[model samples]
Each structure stands twice: as structure tokens, then as C-alpha cells.
Target: MKRLLVTGSNGLLGQKITDLLVQGQFPNFEYIASSRGADRFDAKAYHYLDLDITHHAQVLKAIETYSPDIIINTAAMANVDACEREPAKSYEVNVAAVANLIKICEDRNIHLIHLSTDFVFDGEEGPYEEDDRPNPVNIYGEHKMAAENLLQQAACPWSIVRTILVYGVLRDLSRSNIVLWAKNALENGQPIRVVNDQWRMPTLAEDLAKACLVVAERNATGIYHISGKDMFSICEIVEAVIEHYRLDASFICKEASEALNQDAKRPKRTGFILDKAYEKLDYVPHSFGEGLKLIDEQLAKLQSS
Candidate 1:
């Protein structure tokens, strides 16, 4: 069986991928899911480890111990505002860690699958293509873009999957992801102020996880923009969440600017053109409407449970 190492295995995307793998969504692979935490699992195939990739020795040790044929790096310091505040720590984990992983992967001849963000673009004239030049407005984007550059310069084969506005579990229980924030706000009879000016293609965590598996299996190298089909503003998405949850539509108020709360400058638009993913990976991204329905269904189940 081909062994695969999935980093950030406890994170939102990582957990989804782990579930899919565990439930036999992807067959014919031996999976090792590592996180900074997580202890329990049903079987021995799941090995949870405390991996702080900021330390090169720890990273190298993990890779050497796993000896995985494929390495998926999902670990990153992705808090946008936090990144702006702590740019050095962000670079250590987001950029330097990736560089170390690339070195190990190259030496071992392992296929490296790296996750990136749409934030890498400044969002100026967005719906960016694979070949578009990246001009990041914030430190988070800078770190992500820097990592992408490092992976590109590496000798080993690597696949960079850039996703936007990922929503699903493992995001903060209260106010982590945009969709959930809207859900909780409406549930608690509170109003939400979402920015209408910024636009992005929101990707579901499940879809991204499946896409990652596809990209890894195909060994497709270079950058691929895997995002939702339609573009939406933050306010529009919040509205969709409200509508889906049967909440008061008026709960979500549109804000003209995110500048007041946002510590770093955000781009007006930063979605992607995914024809390359379709052509190469045979990837069929979910439309925003369809994705919304899925999220609603999941939320409903959670409520009932």
C-alpha cells in the first residue's frame, strides 16, 4: 500500500480528509494523520503525533520516521489578523516550515502536496488564473506567497492547491469561518456586519479535501486554483447562510468597509479561474448554491444532534 503523510491532520481540511479516508472515500492508501494534538482513533492505521513544523529537526524527523511516498502539508498559521500582528511567527510556520518539508521531500523523492490561499493575490482584478502574478496586501498573503515561491524553487515534484474562504468544521466554534459566524449570529438573534465590497470563491472543506486527494493521486505538479464555481461578497454569503438556516434575513447587515475591524488590508476580490483544475485534474468544483445547500444540511444535522 502506498503510504501518505497528512500534516495538519487535526485541522478543518485535514480532519475532513481523514474522515473521508477513514470512511473508505479514498482506497488503496495507508494514511498517517499527524497534528499538534489529537490522541484517540479507532484503529492502528491512525498515528497521531505532536509535530511543530517550525522546528526543522522535528519536521525532518517526522518525515524520516513516516517515510511517506506522498506528503500533504496543511499546517499553517492562517489567522489573517494574527498573521499581521505576528509576521515573524507566521513566516516561521507558513514559509520556513514549508521550505524544510520541501527539502525532506526532495531528498526522499516524495511527492509534496502543499495547500495555499487565495489571499496570495492582492485581489486587484481578481478571478485570478494559475499564471497570474501574485501581489499580496497583507503578511498572511506574503507568507503564503513566499512558501509558494519556495516550493516552486524546490527540486522535487510538488503540487500547490490554492483555495479561497474555506468553510467547515475546526474553524472556531464561535466565530472562526464566515458561514459559521453568520449561522451562530442568526441563531443567537444577533446582527452581523459583513463586507460587501470584497469578493471571493468560497470553497467547502470537504470539496477541498477531495480535491487534494485527486491532485495527490494524479501527481499533478505546479499550481492549481481549486475554488467554488461562483463569486460572492461576504455579505452575500452571510445572506445565503441566513436564508439556508431559515433565519431572519435582516440579521446580516452589509458593511461598506472591513477596514475598521481588519488589522491588515484585504483585497477587494481574490477568487480564481479553475479551468486548469478541470482540464488537468478532472475537478468539478461545486457551485456556491450547491455548496450552501450542503453546508445547510450539515448545520441542520449538527443542530439536531
Candidate 2:
């Protein structure tokens, strides 16, 4: 690859990509990391630019200016309830932004690797395969599925990576994931109601990052399912977190999905059958415990730092 540009450079997966390339994975490829605001990543090994993918003119100009060999689009309005509350805004980011990127990539012959979620499936029958028909049950899933549809029709070379329940700690701590949330709640002995009805194969941000680059390096095409090796209910996943940290589990109140009364209706079960990602991308994800162990170390390091 001549040049690889990543959007949402400040995000967990994007930062992990930067970490990889900085540590000499694909050392020769010129890297560009972009996000809407100022660069948040601490590494200066690669070029950083401010990019808001939702802004059409700016995105068009950036693509023309940099003309990267590959562009990994990781920026999206991912909050399900947020998407439900504000659909037009969500579409502008999730679907319309992707359309712009596809058009630009189509024109420039730049390979586009877009991040999607397992939510594309309705959770009626999953773990889903690569060719499984999408029937998104919520607005967020609908928009992501819509983006996937756009990529499928696009003339440019493209790959869609669908992941689930991504979790990891970053240097900047811009956001939190379920693992950390559970850890903190348990630490404080705060009673948190966690849903037991929903199930997922949680993904590590680093694993997802590696999977993306693997897809790009191997020139993989079509949809790839990338996530953790094991599946668990949300409550079980949290319990694992508590066990890993040796925190109090009495704080966790196991509850059904309906009790949460979330603004968006989540899928009952949506996991991916990763045989394609394994055979095609040579992708191997860490087990849930393995992933949590890494995070434990990272958290300690972060505390020290």
C-alpha cells in the first residue's frame, strides 16, 4: 500500500491502528490519521489531519488532496438510542457520509475499508454468516446496513468489517465501554442493572484494528465478521469483568433487556460466524479472558502513566 488513511483517528480502534503502524507493522506504508476535531492521538510518527467525514465538500477536498491508497472509515454515529432520537442527524453521519466516501473512492480508485456492527442482523438467527441477509431491527442497525448496501453497489474496491461490543482503554480516555463501566461500578459497589437477555461476542479494539489492517494488506473484499471467539450475555460479560478484576459482583443486578427501557430496541442475539474472517484474513481474535487480561495490564499502565 502506498498510503493508508484512517478516519476517526482518535477512536479506540483508530488509535490502536496508529499504535500498530508506529510499532512497525507495515512500516513502509505512509499513514494519515484524521478526525473531526484536533488530533487526540499522542503519536507523531504519522501525519494527522482534521477531517469531518460528514461534511461533503471538506471530505471531497481531503480525498483529492491526500489521494490515499486506502481509506479506513471508522467514524459513525454508533449510539443506538441517539440514532433513534435523531435519525436525520444519524443518517448524515452513518449513511450519507459513507455515500460520499464511496463516490470519492470510486472516482479515485482508493480502497475503502468501512467498520460496521453485527447489528445489521435482526438477531432472529445468529451467529450470522458472511452472506446472511440483513434485517436490521433498529435505526442504528438500519443505517449501518444501508451503508453496507452502498458499499456493495460501489465500483471501488471495498471491504466491510462487522464487529460487536468493542472495548478497550485509550491514552486520552475519550469514552468508556462496557468492560470499564462494569469494572468501575463494581469497584464502587454501585448497583448497576445489566441486561441478561442480549448476547454478543464482544470484540477487543486492538483485535478489530488488526483485522482491519489484515483485510487491507491481503486485499480482501466483501463482508468479514470479526469479533471475540466466545459469546455471552451482557450480564455474563460483566460478571467476567468482575471476576477478572476480583471486584464485588454483588453490585450487579441481572435484569432482562425490557427492564432497561432503552430508547433503541436492541437485538436479542447477534453474533458473527467468523470462519470467513479466519480463512480469508488469517484473523484470530483473543478469547474474552485473554482480551480482559490485556486490558487489565493496560489499565495498570495507564494508572502509572
**Candidate No. with top lDDT:** 2
Candidate 1 C-alpha RMSD relative to the actual structure:
2.1
Native-referenced Cα lDDT, model 2: 0.90
lDDT digits (tens) for residues 17-44 of candidate 1: 8878888877867888887755333345
TM-score of 1: 0.94
lDDT per model vs. reference:
0.84, 0.90
Best by TM-score: 2
Superposed on all Cα atoms, model 2 deviates from the true structure by an RMSD in Å of: 0.9
What TM-score should be assigned to candidate 2? 0.98
